[model samples]
Target: MTLKQDTTSITTSISNPTLLAKVDQLRDLNIGQHVPLPQLVVVGDQSSGKSSLLESLSGVPFPKDQNLCTRHATQITSRRDKDECVHVRIIPGPRASEDHKKQVEAFQTKVSSASEFRDKFVDILKKANEKMGLRTDLSSGHGGAIFSEDVLKIEVHGPREDYLTIIDVPGIFRTTVHGTTKDDMVMVKNLVKRYIRDDRTIILAVLPSNVDIATQEILELAEEYDKNGKRTLGVLTKPDLVMEPTMRASVCDLVMGQKRPLTLGYFLVQNRSSDDGVKTVSELDQGLRIQPWSDLPKDRVGILALKEQLQSLLLDITRREFPKLVQDVASQIRQCTVELNKLGPSRQDEREQRSFLSRMAGIFQDRARAGLAADYNAHSSFNQTDLRLITHVVNLTDVFNADFQRLAHSRHFSSLEESQPLESPEPSDAGDRSESQSGLSVDTLRVLLEESGVDKISPKEQMELAEILVLPKDIPMPNEGFTDWIKEVYLQFRGLELGTFNPNLLSVAFTEQSRKWGDMTRIYMSRIIVTVHRFIAATLRSICPEEPTRIQLWAEILEGLLDCYRKAMAQADMLIQVQQRKQPYTLNRQFAADLSKSRGHRITALLRPKAKEDRRFAEPQYMVNLDDIAEAAEGKHNTELLQEEIHDILHAYYNLALDRYIDNIFQLAVDHSLLHGPDSPLKVFTQDWVLNLEARQLEDIAGETISEKKRRSRLSKKITDLHNALKILKSRDSY
Candidate 1:
């Protein structure tokens, strides 16, 4: 089945305006420097009429020779204009910028005459090869040579030109030639791959009809980059070379998508060979009208059809990609702006330096205040909850208090009555007799006897007989063994006595338990300090305009602030340690209340009746002596009450201390060290102090290097181009 021809429609399609003009505007702004742009990348094997096809489409006679035609990528951009002119230039690869600059100075020019354009074009390419260090000497014995990935750009403007831009890359080769090495073959293939790999690119895979499509490396490479073949268009160049009927039929099958179909399909074009001389568009058109061509579909052959198809494809792609391209440019602009801000300003003198430092100081001060106030919104770096240093301190305080309270109630500090046996069944009669005989003066024995009777006597009775009866031995007399034993038992019950306060065993337990507070708080404080340090560094870099001054001042400020932070943290830790030492202060009224409550609960639990299952009789009654049980329960209840009081006091004090420690951290570590002006390390940035720095030091600190200047220039250019590209896109009604 032969495809029908539409010669008039094809001609009209070629003349229609395309979105290539918009694409050219994007290229002109060099948006590709930051992001890939929509393009048509032409790729094929060596001597596949790639140059001829490009020359025909562009109407520019590109140099054709084994070594001169295509070494690096040559971008040919043509547009319709009233004036007829040609402009040529080179966009150097990253590593070859200097050579490119030199070449531009020597070879960049404009031409109006076709002959002059051709002659000057070849000269520029040869010079570009030299500048790019691409060796032209094939005769050199050493066949290995490197090729450059640089591009030579040519632009043409004329009334007859279509608004289009296409990239013609070095043709792929199987083996090394004079100036080209096996590496060069790889380099060219890689270059082609880079272009085709871009989703926005429309790949034109050129191949001569004489060569087997299987042997064409570019077709395989294109397939590799565009596996679905959605954007790949096969251009079977040198269609005139297929003389045999069988071969023609095969070519027809390829074009008609019968063999190895591409999504975009194929077009057969009769491109002018080297011996065909410089043929005009009219002559090429006239030639295609001949015998075999007349029998073929008009839309499937000739440059007009190829141009129309390319324009249509490029426009479709551009429309699809334009919005994204705008968004990308805007994103890049923001990124570059951020980077430039980080690099800081190029301060020319002391005044600017002082102003810059002052501004940075102000920003730092504001952020520090925000941190202290726990205002997360004021600074993006601070998290809403934990990252705010004050909030973190508060959280830590809660944890510390909870831990302290837990320790106070732990079994380690439980009352001796609950934790140990009540007594050793009062000493044996033999032991008691031995003690009584061993050593007690009459008076001491009498006093002990009186103390033993005290519980039997009422408090009123003891007060009434105070003068007649000798006072019980509050102080033990010498040679009194019984009195000594009484004192020892009293001391054991008291745990350890410090002054008037009998510091509960809970204190000792807590000291050991909370020892990690110092180290933990230290680690926590260190993180806060580091966070503030990084913030200061980043803030200084962004706000300060002078690079040299920013570096020097940042170092000095960081050192001083960290030193102040260290001192403040030490002070806060000292408070924590002091609180730790005085732990378990159980002097609060709440302690008494809690202790009473606990005692009541314990007594109630003891008095409560047992379950019916535990009893053998249907009616359960007092099997044991109620009086003896009540007396024992009373003693145990008193012991538990005392222990509970002590633990309650300790917990109350721990809570108070934790609260005080948190306040101290905020007051000392955060407020004084970071937020306070005169005492803060950040005070060094005061306008007077910065302005008073020696001129020589300022110069040394703020000096800009050549590389820095170059970087700034490049960034500035990129930002401007991005902004321009964005403007262009925004102005378009379709966008």
Candidate 2:
């Protein structure tokens, strides 16, 4: 056959070049670097005739030898144009440094004829391999970098070419032989898998008919990714070598889909080896027309039929994926644009740096204001707990108040009798304390007589009570039992010729009752400090685009935020000091009411006449009758009444002081000084603060660093290229 007829026999006809060219354009823009694009990828075992297949399909003679193997991924793209031309270039990997990328991209060549391409291809491959840090010799060890992920891109344009693009990756191999190490074997396998694993890629599984298909690693990987064989097309190569009937029938069964069935089925093709003289397509077709191959389907044979199938399949895939490709490109464009915006414009000089700082400060203030006001609708960040300033403040204050009510007292009184030790308190007996309400009531003062079932007392109190209870009964139990410990104090401090004890006793008892105020409030203040720090960080991250910038700004203002927090803590400490003043005093009406009610309860319980022995055994009872209270008031137990009076007064004053102190801490220290007022930590990054900064300080906080500028430039270029890609997809005209 003549050369024209031979070329025409292998040429793939294209009905819709526009769709394929759009795909080729997207691949040219390197859109696949950011996202996976639809295309055909050739994968197989080492020396499996993958290069021979590419040569047949592209009509370009590739350098071939028995020991030669594909060293890196090669992307071959062919498009229809007026003149026949070839262009080769290197597309750097993602991890390549900027300088290395420039050096790699600088390697480019152009050829005007097929003969020139064939003559120069081997030398070009050798150069590309050496540039990738590998020796050209397949069995020689010369470099540390054994394998690469970079791609060698070749663009072919000619009047007779079909619009097609195929990515050929390094073949999978089992043994680490020759120049290959174990890591190199694994790397090649991983590289092939990465390309074929993309759903948009159509896998061309090349299998040699001379070898068992099951043993080939490429088919296993193809099945692994394309489980149903939906996107995979099987290509049987070296069919001329299967001479035996049994072996030929096995290959034919695969070709006819009788064994290991695939959705796209299989095709058989004969590739010319290096030892074979210049052979025509007619000779290749005649070889496939023999007995076992002729019995197989006609559509699944020869190089021309395989080319036609590949082109049609690729067109279908490109058409189906075009809209999605456009959408992905647009989405990535928006993302890159947003990243560029976050980096903001160049901030080289102090004025520009100050301007950038001012803008950041404005954003910080807006977010901080919204967070402090609980206006969650203002910013999405306010919904986060660490950034919800007001909500955390309220929750923390409520928790602090509850902790004081439950834990502030050194000892607690229990109403349960010794026999009913584990029973829960009656609902009516539970106290309802709040920030504005007193926590103590008559139920809180029900001191246990036997002391066995008393709740909330420490181990120390229990030990002391045990010692007191063990005292001899003949030793005047009135001043000996646990109940009269306070009476002993009153007696010791009594003034001359008076029924009342000295007022100093009240101050001393009250001071001891609220003694934990300092440590507890300090802990509470520390918690608030943490909340402030978190809020500031969350707000800054939401406002700043880069991590380094956020870190620098944090360093600039971290000390100030802490200083404001410390000042607020000092103010809170002042409130605690007020609770420890020389005299216990309060004007709250509730204190007097609580005191009177407790006194009446104590007096009535002490003076009631004893019940009958059987009735007392049936149920525990307390004296609550008005007549009993009046009778108790008329009795003469001066020391007992005086002790009970002192206890009641101390409890009432404690409850009143606790309520007011919690309010003071929240309003004066937390709200006024730390969060919202003039000393607010959020105000540390204001516009005025930026204006006051020195030139060096401004640059340190806001100036863009070398890496940041490089990142910005990269993103800008990516966005511009993606936009251009989108336009290419939208264009309706043919090239």
Candidate 3:
């Protein structure tokens, strides 16, 4: 075949025989060690003619004696070629040591001619057994492995070759026999399962016609892996040994697919006999031309038909599985390439190490900026909640603001309860509101006057006096219940003035109101630090996938970021001390407006009594009168009014200060000092930072160790092999 192709169709399609050869080529590349490849795997119980079937198909002489059995798996690859050749070698198992692999790989030999391979092949099998540590002398005291996972690979080329690959494993055995130990039985079954479990493998279940077909273990296992018998092919051997009429009928039933049906049904074949030693297809067919066999289909009873069937089956599976195999190989190449890129170029010296650090620092800065800015499109990780620094910080500040607003106050403000006045029906709007109101009626009032044995008043006046007597008590002052406490605080900070008090009372009250700020701010600052910590950790992992290097960077960079957070927290505490411990002060205009607004509401409630029909609580009209003002100032209620004014002033200042402090904590403390700008925590990893590091520190951070060097070498070799495998799939071939 010639390897040349157009790029488009090469990736998407391949011809049947070429695809089959592609699988063989990949197997030769040892890609099967990394991924499953499509092939036929022959399996059966011991003495079930597994080796005999392989011999008939490959035209190889397999030893089938009463005392000897296959100890390890043998992989035979046959390809059609003009020149005849046979090459044999050993492929070590995964558990084999490096020294053992080198030892086994040297057992390669090329046969001069396929026609003259019988004598050399037997000697080669013996040498292969020795290499795998399988005992050659069953009678000798030299002990060896009962079963080996290592494979003996035989590649053959001849004019009559079919594009096929077959693996013949040691047959399953339920009990120990001959010189084999109990462990041998378990190892053999396990080896069979490892091959058959792969979905790409077609199971060749070899059954002897002389034994009960229902008693075979290999068919049961095939059913386990291939529930619908899709990939299982049944081969019936030793038909000549079944002499009885019933046994003959049973073999005929299986061959006709009347019992234990398989998707790729049974084939009956006769091996070269021990008596006459017949070795030709005609002689083998003559042995099967008996009562039941003669009546069976002509195509299902000979070695020639079995060979054609296997070749067709192998071709069909290759066509079905080649596309997926190519995809798997390509996908593995991409994954390995990404991992190799992550490891990056070697850092052999101080200059290279420093360069590596500088590059990584740049990546860190970019990702950190993107995360802090909430620019999720920059990296997929920015969309993740843990790495969303801006979103988390904003949400934390919102919660902090809400908690401060709700819990930072020393006393709760009472909402004014408006009185619902009952309106006596007006002349035109009669019963509009009175019908909805429930109050004393005129008839009940008159009955009460009569029962008191007093003179009866006029009906209208009686109703009016009854409504006036039933009017709810004047709406009480909002903080009248807290007056005692207010008086105590006022007296403690009293000055020489009669009604005015020292401003120290307002400051002390504010200090108590904001007592929880310190503890709450500490917790809030701690949560912000944690949020930044998680974001930085995620960013580092994204930029540096290698574990050792990431760990070193984390150890170097995290402490400096934490120190920044500590400084930011110290700044926040200083602001709290300025607001709480010092005399309260603010230039905000909202304080004056809020104080005026509160006093106006209180004065309106005090000046106007509850009106009978004033349900809207309308503002009372203000009239400037010197006499009325003098009377109010000298009245008995003046002290209470003064107390209310002081309370209003303190409350207004508290509202103004609350908003300012929350903003300062978020901006000055968290956003400015810790998260944003050139000297912020996000700027901790930079090219400048790397340049300042000493040579030893740079080496410690980025230098490769011995194990790391070995890993890099191993990955480089694996990536090379995978790339070659992809080229094999994409390269065009002409048969």
Candidate 4:
């Protein structure tokens, strides 16, 4: 409600708060056991609908309404912490760590041979994901291509900060620099090799719907990337490219292979097809389709396969792997200390680089306190959970403080002496400088450090520098939504039920079942959350949610988070089992993936035939494939049926809420609760009732929309005056 009064910091706007704040929060949540916002790294060549798929997955209008969602290996980490924005960063440098040299070498090679510097930047994350050994090979450019090792980092905000990290690798092979695409299995292998320090991360490699499993990368990435070498689920992006359900199913089978209990599932996405604007949460959910192979069109069969694979994986991760990830990433961080010592120095500096958790404490406390205040609720069960949340924050700081501290200040110590002279060797050995066991010479390290603006530091000190910050790594997003403590305030003060669970409450648990309701609530809640979030975010930090079209921007962001919720809730059977066994009956767990249906696109007679000029594109490419689009649209109602459904769903929700509203208002009135007070449930309800009663006021506002008679008269007069002015100007010029 309060706008920013502070103007000292120029970057602080009504969008993002601060970059450091976001990182600090990410670190705290991560340390506090919420780490690794798993990302679905969608990789492909330029214009291969990589952006389109991301847009669909992220629910952003993308190409139609915004610029490239990615400039590098950009990741869309879900807003898992709280009021978070869909942030994108062009990787400006590699990560700073003891192993930073390896990252630098990989990026340098990508930069030297690449057609675009940005692709090299993307290579860093792709390589990092590859190292983690996940199926991340489904890059978009020049068909599928393999991503050489690169550094990748992703953070998300929702109910928590710690989640999976899905990386969007560079669309591949557009140039000779990017190599080739591998199967999911290979992608997984590479991802594990590079980024997945533990079991916490999963790679969701995106493939074109037009392409099939026969594409070596599609099949191979799964083969190589799958857990225990099992196949991966496929995400058949752009279902509009294919229409036949039979073909879609076949593709699903072909990509899924012969895995027991099926290793994959597909999902149909049309992020680009969001023709009408979406304002409410229900609309966001009506768009995601996580159904069976038989139910999907030929193009989405791949997506369906991917969805199934992911669903099963999600269940496995939540059940079997989650606990282990906590242990593993921690172990890996410890191992990083060992790696730092083994690779470079005998001891960590433990000075300049404080533990991530330690450096972030102040930021965390400020955010936590603020978040608690904003999200305070006397009746909710979680009201008592705040102390626990704060405790979790402190506990996390403790768990990783030692490990992070050791790693953070590694630079204050040196891996090797700056002046350590290289032993002169034979010509044959001289050619292998990079392959040398000791790495580049101290002089070389010092020179490199100096070039990077560290002349005051020694080569040993440079080596001590964090590998995550070495080269031009991805730039952090503008601090619009980043905060140390996230206070998520669901817009509906009185919780609304999308299904069995209170939509507000159901949002906390990340399951595949509650996703639908979660989707609906997210959008509906966003209308209020984003407004307040922007106001506070600006006051707090840098970057504001400054855009000409606020609704479209919101729709774009809400759409993406909505996708994540649905994806998380896609596995209903397991979620239901877990909830019934553990706690309450939640919406997603109760009703996700209950139907195997489609938006059912149908071509109408009035629909113009596809000519050389595809109406979708303003201009016709000489090599336009009219049959492809026409065949794609075949029986599909390529119409606004989905939007219509969303409209119905929203009004239904409003109608349902209206009943409760009326009853509550009547109850308060009977109790004689209305009084002169600033804060009271009865008073608030009375005010709301009055606002609702102002139908006449709404009419007055609506009446101004067209007012053609007066508007036209004013415009006509202005035009005459303008004509006269032009004449006078012309005369003056002549004189």
Q: TM-scores across all candidates?
A: 0.58, 0.64, 0.63, 0.29
What's the candidate order when arranged by decreasing lDDT? 2, 3, 1, 4
Name the best candidate (by TM-score). Answer: 2
Candidate 3 local lDDT, residue 151: 82
lDDT of 1 by residue, 184-232 (tens): 7777787888878988999999989878888888888888889999999
lDDT of 4 by residue, 480-571 (tens): 22111111322222244342223332223222122232222222222212222222222222111223222322332333333322332233
Q: Pairs clashing in candidate 1?
A: 138-178, 345-545, 548-701, 584-650, 586-649
Q: What's the lDDT for candidate 2? A: 0.74
Cα lDDT of model 2 by residue, 568-631, tens digit: 8789888888777669887789998988876656543455453223445558555355665556
Q: How does each model score on lDDT?
A: 0.63, 0.74, 0.73, 0.33
Off by over 4 Å in 4: 1-40, 43-48, 60-71, 80-165, 174-200, 227-231, 243-249, 252-262, 273-319, 329-735
Q: List candidate 2 stretches off by more than 4 Å.
A: 1-5, 9-12, 66-68, 144-146, 332-357, 364-558, 561-682, 692-721
Candidate 1 Cα lDDT to native = 0.63
Clashing pairs in 3: none
Candidate number with greatest lDDT: 2
lDDT of candidate 3 over 353-392, digit per residue (tens): 8999999889888887787778889977676566777866
Question: What total of clashing residue pairs does each candidate reach?
Answer: 5, 0, 0, 158
